[model samples]
Target: MAVFQAVRANQEESMRTLGQVKPWCAGILVGTVLAAGSLVPSSGFAQESVSVRAALVKGALPADDPSASAWNSTPASEFPMSPQVHWPNRIQEVTVKSVKVRALHDGQQIAVLLEYEDPSQDPDDAAGLEFMVGDKKAHFAHGQPMAQVQGGPVNIWYWKNKDNNALDMNAQGFGSLKVQDQQDVKAKGVYQNGTWKVVFSRALSTPDVEHDTQIKPGDFINIAFAIWDGKKLESGDLKEKGSQKAVSSWWYFRADPPPDYSAYYYVALAVGLAAGFQFVIIRKLKKGATS
Candidate 1:
């Protein structure tokens, strides 16, 4: 009986010592993994912004104006236009999120849902999102909020062509937008059937956002929505018989755009709780064996 008690006592001490050692191992391993992951390249942004209510989701009308032909938006089966995007990857297929607006006077909220079809699937090559911040010229994380960078004509748009693939801004709001690796025109591109979700948000860097406003969080816009599409080159202009075209989508939020408030909190929580916790548990086992 005395031996039995002694054995159990030893076991408890062993466990306690293991516990203290666990944190040390965990802290080091986690820190190391994080450091390495940081070095490895990833998408410019971590979590992407979702479909938001569109103050304006505009695509340049086909120079030919296909809308004149008239097509049915109410499809019995699926989207009418196939993934006509010249190169699906050029116009990255991603889910747009909800956007909200608020009143400046009374701080009222308006909500509108924005949904888009993300048919793009070329993970090997990807497109980019760009905006202006002033004369300094800044870049936006692929899924970060869009804000007015300059005081006057604070325009923001990304390039679509190979040469202009980088994001650029011009006063016209349309001059900078061009297709990349463009070839003879086909059914250029379309955002066929896909998941639809929306978010409620407030404007970020517009003139109104910078200035003091009565609006608070949770305010939403009523008519918020977005529509995005890309264009192609003329058929005869292309030299190759089977040349391809590329297109892109531009987006905007209406009713007072919202600041991205949840990315930092959500990403940290996921990595810290799930990934971070797993590291801690593994460490406990290793230390126990060492002791």
Candidate 2:
């Protein structure tokens, strides 16, 4: 397209100028260009899609630590949190406006870090990740009705600030949350500087295949989120349950497969060849002027 060609021309001009200024600048530009090119959609066309990308790493992922250095390289996706207005016990006022999410995977396991601003440190506060099941559509808040769970059941990974561990739970519509027998989810939360950072981690696959969502590399999964601010008197009581928290609509989540560097190699080679050709042309032009 004309747009792509123009963008490529601009990039080439920038790179040539930088290459003449300093060799190190050209190297940095190469890296920057490569990163930008990698972000283009595989379809060769761009469209709007909201999803949390889990970067694939080589070794172990940072499980419980929210301040781990590995997270620095991982890109963050922030989703707005809104009051739950669907249920009777819904939150009319929003205490937590938004949450920043970052994720990483080590091929075998995946870890997600959630960061939010909260003035009061309520260890009683709770947060969790909810996943949809199958291709069938269900209520994003809870899930399908209990009797119709066969159509689709929601899997939840819940963690309370006061608890030392996370709970693997399931739900089918309202008032149907049940803790699973297999407690495979692990979490850790820390409060500092008027903010709460929590990290949750679990294996890619579990034995409870029927109830649990199997996460695979390069697969798009539907995910939702919920957070309860205990400072606002949100609790687990049936009378005050339902929607007394903040929730998000269904969003996509994907664990990226390992990256391929062959494109980078080819691009770098082309740039080098282009630079050599430009140098030869400039030298010949200068020689002609002198003669």
Candidate 3:
């Protein structure tokens, strides 16, 4: 009879100990499973990409307004700029160290806002957006040499502070810049408090497909930039002199696609599975403790 009592006491203690550990075990299992689920490539668990995203908006985009309230809704992608040293008339000094870029799309048109600091608002100040074409692989400086035009061509949307609109241009090499016959790019710029704000806007697709880098929604494209500070006498038209400018390397630009809710469903499924697994494990532990 004494031996029986001892065995009963031992079983009771074991059950109590298991009861104390049950919750902790279940919590650990659930935590680990959920952490793994979060890593799944679902929209709910997706991280931001390294490209400049043009967010789609319901209302009209602020085409030429740098201070428009519509622009406040989008996030900015800041890129560092360096002196253009690949070609002749290279920038000896870097005046513009960085540029803050924001983009918006209204399904039909897109607008890009570029803001940078400049101590003086020089009349010769100009900004440009350049993208690759043809082979889509060439020197980012502008393009390959004219003799090697078959290598690739580049489309440029050049905007000057003195002009009411941006110029549609193209180039194959350093001194091979030419204005396009079709002008579809529009731009406006404002300077205040030692800062310059410029906005460039155009239709998502243009008829001049030969010379324009046609932009499409939900597409990834390579792009570069240049800024000519008039105070420094940087010139885009005169390749022989004053060609020094701040430039950027190739970067990606993408228009955000429509929302996908399938990821939410997957996340919900994963959470359900984790809860079910925890319940099963706890049930087995409880059964063992009781027995």
Candidate 4:
């Protein structure tokens, strides 16, 4: 507990000092710490799954471009879901057993293809409707118990087909979701043969946005997914009277980085040892010559 508290304190102090002095540096420091495994678990799930390498590409893939079809060949990471409940509000177990995700990246951009099974196309009806809590427009989702946290906000890219398009949401907790106006995300959804394949693409880093997580080639990030089966009438309860349910990915869907080469400390130590060994050999040769 003390160690955790100390880490929190140091992190807070560092943010306060660095954010004001150099925001870019602060962002780099935070990313470095996260990548180093000091904060979040930087590993895959205990269960075995295919590795989805965000293979480096020359440019970002286009939404309808045929060349992007190659990404479909990559191995997918399957994730299971556990039904979520909030007291009287119980969203039964997800309709699908697992979701398959494949990712591709080109140092500067990332594209993720999410595939899941759904019998019918269930599109979101309410895209612009204000989420209300009692009489007032609530900043977050109402009736969701575990939605809000001081530090854990989720970035969601939701697709409502081509008509409603995609919405970029910053969710602090269940009902407390804010739509981002200046979203950089692009998504395309295709429902055919009783399956839904959606692609989400975005810039690896958005420096001006605090809500965005800056991603690089070799950085692990937690990704969780939710599916609202439209056929089952799983729309927002406030709009549909609490019957709404979504199959949610197990607490986290871990995205592992490609080959990581950021081992400067170890590399420096090895170099020093090799130099010292060479120096010792030279000294022995000199002593031998003198003798």
Candidate 5:
């Protein structure tokens, strides 16, 4: 009888220990899964795994237009910056780690609003905007100065706030930069509340212009962005060290179709109809009762 009692007590203790260990084991497993997920490379921006979508809006999109207020309702994708390619081994401490981009397009026009933080708002030679547009998709390091993919042809729209209100031109290959005698690109920049909001807009298609890349609706294109924080003294390869100093460089962004809101409209219409019917039924019941 004594031996049996001791055995039963041991069994109960063992069961209690197991119950405590089970929770710890589960917690460990959850922690391991979360740690592994964090190790994966992601910009933590909205819809980064999938292509970034642009929302289509009505009417003409002017570069200087306050229409970007509409983009506030659109989803934004975050773009991260890394060091330029010239110095591969050195990790750069970039001020602009991420840029928030929202795009809007009418069938005939497309515009992108780039919002980033810069305390200085350097209007001097320090601040500039670089836009790379490609019709076809290909993989290549966009960090290289004048970088180009073997099969992909990219058209560049370069803008400097200190310069004329036009965009400088460049192509994929080296020595392809051509500053136009006249500017076809429309750009308007505003620095307010320690953030620079710049809008770049153009027609969907521009033919017979070597510098301009023709764009169309429902077309899949590759876009990349670079920003020079003048306060950081970021310019391209100025020191001859083969490094383009910039606060940030975001490359390899794929453009998705504009957001479609048709389903929401239909839903609203259905709800409105249901409410009207309910109201009419209530009124009819009240009239019958009074009569």
Candidate 6:
């Protein structure tokens, strides 16, 4: 008890000098909340089930151009290429066809398999969604293609370069067999089946990590299917390079995070407190000299 008190006192004192007391306090509060086994999120880390619905829109796409892939090619990072996950323009024309979510440790997620039809009859290369597993990019394609990662592999990730009409490992497709971070969710596109299909999956863990431990039963999961016009990539484009313009899909994973620290609010509060303290000190000295 004494040691714990001493540690708490030290944490408090550190905030005073560092002008980070509030953030520290907030962090502590958040930590306590999680430790007490009371799970909830103030924002991004909130534990709840998110459902998404994306049915064909009115004249969604002309049946004549059913082969056309949505999207107009964006950076490797970001989706529809938006930083915000819930952005309106990010990915549209999507719906939660089906969702099966479970818990994995402190985090939860929704796992699903999306299917898009490739109405395009001609063979075309596909530049599917690109998700980040750490710094590495997970490119999805109609047929699996070459891969290189700046960090470690997403463990259970792989792509089949087989140029089959359907994106089957027993067929052909590229995706993150493993997921590093929810923020790492990237974008890819391809025309598959008799229409264009782009599948997206998001797995989030409260722990700040690129990937999280696997999922177990009873964990709450959130799922959404956004519809985004497939960003068209040139034949030379990465998403559409090899066998482009087929169907695209991505699989995200939840990895484990080391048990430490507090919630994001605490971190933000700590920073805010530090900033406020610095501001107060500066003004305090100025006023003191004037007085």
How close to the true structure is residue 16 of candidate 2, measured as C-alpha lDDT? 68
TM-score of each: 0.20, 0.69, 0.74, 0.57, 0.57, 0.22
lDDT, candidate 6, 2-80, per-residue tens: 9999999988887665554455555665676577575553556222223211211222222122123421111111112
lDDT of 3 at 109: 90
TM-score of 6: 0.22
lDDT of 1 at 248: 25
- lDDT, candidate 6, at 205: 31
TM-score of 5: 0.57
lDDT per residue (tens digit) for residues 17-113 in model 1: 6665564566777797899788987657311232222222123222222122212121111111122133223333323222221112112322222
Q: Number of clashes in model 1?
A: 35
Candidate 3 per-residue lDDT, tens place, 103-149, comes to 99888898999999987876678899888765457567778654544
Stretch of 10 with least lDDT, candidate 1: 70-79
lDDT of 5: 0.56
| Candidate rank order under lDDT | 3, 2, 5, 4, 6, 1
Best by TM-score: 3
- On a 0 to 100 scale, what is the lDDT of residue 202 in model 1? 28
Better of 1 and 2 by TM-score: 2
lDDT of each: 0.32, 0.79, 0.80, 0.55, 0.56, 0.33
lDDT string, candidate 2, 1-291, tens digits? 999999989878865654443444445557767986898877642112378888899887889788889998977888888888976766687678898888999989999998998778775688889987556655687885545554577889988887856999888777888999888889998888988888999998887787787788899888888887766444644221346778899988998877879999999999998788657655654554455
lDDT score of model 1? 0.32
Candidate topping lDDT: 3
| Candidate 3 segments whose C-alpha is farther than 4 A from its true place | 1-50, 145-150, 232-242, 276-291
List the candidate 6 regions with Cα displacement exceeding 4 Å: 1-111, 114-121, 127-150, 155-162, 165-194, 198-239, 242-291
Give me the runs in candidate 2 sitting further than 4 Å from their true place. 1-49, 145-151, 232-242, 260-291
